[model samples]
Target: MDKIRIKNLELFAKHGVFPEENALGQKFLVSADLYTDIRPAGLTDDLNASIDYGMVCHKIKDFLEQHTFRLLETAAEKLAWSLLTEIAGLKKVTLEIQKPWAPVGLPLETVSVRITRGWHTVYIALGSNLGEKETYLRNAVESLNQADGCRVEEVSEFLVTEPYGYTEQDDFLNGCLCLRTLLTPEELLALLHKLEQEAERKREIRWGPRTLDLDIIFYDDLVMDSRDLQIPHGDMQNRDFVLRPLAQIAPYVRHPILKKTVGGMLADLEHSQKI
Candidate 1:
């Protein structure tokens, strides 16, 4: 990624823990690194191909002046998110919010909070075996599309698959979705669970039939293992229902742990079936 840097742009804002500090206002220094592809802009000599640092600076200043926060942490976080959301061609951002004139009696150069934030690519496997299966899946997709900080980029065609567990229930409508999101893996998982609950999903049996099922299959090549969640989902490579749809959107997405592309995994699965 190429870098566009804006350093120590000053702003006058009323952000502070103390009442006097808020009333009196103070100087806040902001610095940001915009991450994106600059090759096209350089070669084409096109301003539209890259982000304008001047415009971004003005936007940041406006956002800070428009909102009041007591903590620099809050300010930095909000600014980072806003930049990612509002600025086009911006892939990631590193932001620093500095408070140079703190009311501390001791001598200090400055107090600051810094953070890096970016968009993440995520693959989700969706299924429903209960009533109105297609409706459940469609509604789930729509719901995700409407979510904040998330964009539903592509959805694979639904496939009817036999139940994975002991239940002799109806066949499941299964598919996958590719999304770009600002939510962390854990946050995305929580949101999926919430969507399941909204669909009145029950957990009486393992892999049991349900109104809806949503699982996080991949998150930006991340490999994680925890009691509550797992990335590159534990059984994705072996599941045709998951692989088929996932391949439609991201066949070349490499698994961080397995070190195999989705297409490679699917090919391996097909070969195994022949043997």
Candidate 2:
């Protein structure tokens, strides 16, 4: 990842805990490292190929001036989100906000907050076996696209598949989608649960009938396991409903643990079933 650095750009903004600070405002120093691919810009000498630091500076200044926060942490968080969303071609950002004025009786050089934020590519599997299954799956896609900090990039055609663990139920309408999001794994899982609840999903039986079922299949090649959530879903490789649709959209995406592409895994599964 290449970076365009903007350092020590000063601005006056109303952002502090004290009421007097908001009323009178204060000097704040802002800095950012805009991360993106700079090869195209360097090779072609095209400014359009790269993010413009000048415009970004103005954006930062304008954002800080318009928003008021009692904490530097909150201000930095919102500013990082704003820059990542608004600035095209920016993949990651490290933002810093420094307040030089000390309200404390003790002398201090400056108090600052610095943080890094970026978009992460994630794969999600969707399934529904209850009434209006196709409608449920489609609505899930739309809802995710409309959600903040998330964007649906690609979707696979839905497939009608037999129930896996538990039989004697209607087949499932299953599909997968690629999502670009700013949410952490936990946050993403929470959003998925919320969407499932909205669709009236139930967890009465394991892998049984449901109005909607959402699973996190992959998150940027990350491997994590906890009581609450798992990344690179534990059983995705063995499930055709998950692999087939995921392969359609991301065949070359490799599993971090198994080191196999989606297409490769699907082929292996099909072969094993025949044997």
Candidate 3:
């Protein structure tokens, strides 16, 4: 990643814990490090191939002036999102918002809040066996793409397969997705649950057919296990339905625990059937 640094740009904005500070406003300094690959622009000698720093500075100033927040933390977080979303070719942003005139009675140089935000790659498994399964899957993809910090990068073709568990149910339409998101693992999980509920998904019967089933199979090679969520889902390797579609999109994606690529795992799973 290449660095584009903008240091200590001055701005007058209304953001503070004190009402007087918000009303009267104060001088604030903003700095940012916009991370992106500069090779294309450098080689091509084209301004169009790179993100425009001047435009980004204007955007940051405008955003800060337009909104009032109680804390610099809140302002920095929001601005970081705004820049990361609005700027093309920008992969990440490290933002700092500095307040020079602290209301503190003690002698202090300055106070600031800094934050870093960017997109992360994630793989999600999609399944629905009951009621317009295809529609549910499509809706799930669209819903995620509409989210603030999420984008649907690639989607595997839906594959019809026999029910895995609670086998008495109808066949399922299963597939996987490659997604880019800014949300942390837990935040992404919460969003998936919200989408599930919107699709009228119910969990009354274990492994039973449902309106929609969205599982976070992998999140940026992250491995986690807890009461409510698990990354590199516990049963993904054992289920052909999960691996088949996952391999379609990310054949070379290595499982954090298994040390096997998705394609390799699927091949091994298929080979075992002959034994």
Candidate 4:
């Protein structure tokens, strides 16, 4: 990745905790490092092939001047998200917002908040065994596409497969879809739960029948083991249902933890079943 740097871009904005601060406004300095591949623009001498730092500077000034927030943290966070959402070719951004006129009694030069944000590639598995299964799968994909900060990149063909855990129910319509999202894993999981509830999913029985099941199979090679979520989906390597569909879309996407590609895992799982 290459870098485009913008430094010490000063602007007057009303962003502070004090009431008078908001009314009078204050001077702030913002700097950003944008990460992207500039090869196309460099080789072709075309500005359209890369991001424009001049335009980004203007946007930052406008956004800061238009919005009023109490915390620089809030301002920086929202600004980072705005840049990531609005900028077409920007891959990652590191932003620093500096406030020089602080009310603190100390003689410090300045106070600033620095943050980084970017889009992540995620693979999600969709499954439903009850009532109009394929519709549920398609609806899930549509819902993900409609959600803010999420773009559905590709979807695998649906497969009819038997249940995984408690296998007494009818077969399920299973598939996987690739997503580009700005949300963190936890935020993504929350949104999925909301979608499931919209589908009238029941949680009374563990691994029991459900109207919709959405699982995050992979999140940008992230490895996590928090109470609420697990990356690489816990059992994706062992489940033919998940790997079969995921392999179709991202056969070469490697599991960060296991050091195996999706296709390789599917092959191993199938071979083990034969034995």
Q: Highest lDDT among the candidates is held by which one?
A: 2
lDDT by residue (1-275, candidate 2, tens digit) is 99999999999999999999898999999999999999999999999999989999999999999999999999999999999888899999998889999488788999889999999999999999999999999999999999998999999999999999999899999999999999999999999999999999989998889999999999998999999998889998899999999999999999999999999999999999999
For model 2, the local distance difference test gives: 0.95
Models 1 onward score TM values of 0.97, 0.98, 0.97, 0.98
Pairs with backbone N, CA or C atoms under 3 Å apart (clashes), candidate 3: none
> For residues 171-270, could you state the per-residue lDDT of candidate 1 as single tens digits?
8899999998999998999999999999999999898889999999999878889889988799998988899889998999998888999999999998
Steric clashes per prediction: 0, 0, 0, 0
lDDT of 1: 0.92
RMSD of 1: 1.1
Q: What is the C-alpha lDDT of each candidate?
A: 0.92, 0.95, 0.93, 0.94
Tens-digit lDDT track of model 4 for 1-275 = 89999999999999999998999999999999999999999999999999999999999999999999999999999999999989998889999999999888799899999999999999999999999888888999999999988999999999989888887778888999999999999999999999999999999778788899999999998999999999979999989999999999999999998899999999999999999
Q: Return the candidate ranking by lDDT, descending.
A: 2, 4, 3, 1
TM-score of candidate 3 against the unseen true structure: 0.97
Number of the candidate with higher lDDT, 1 or 4:
4
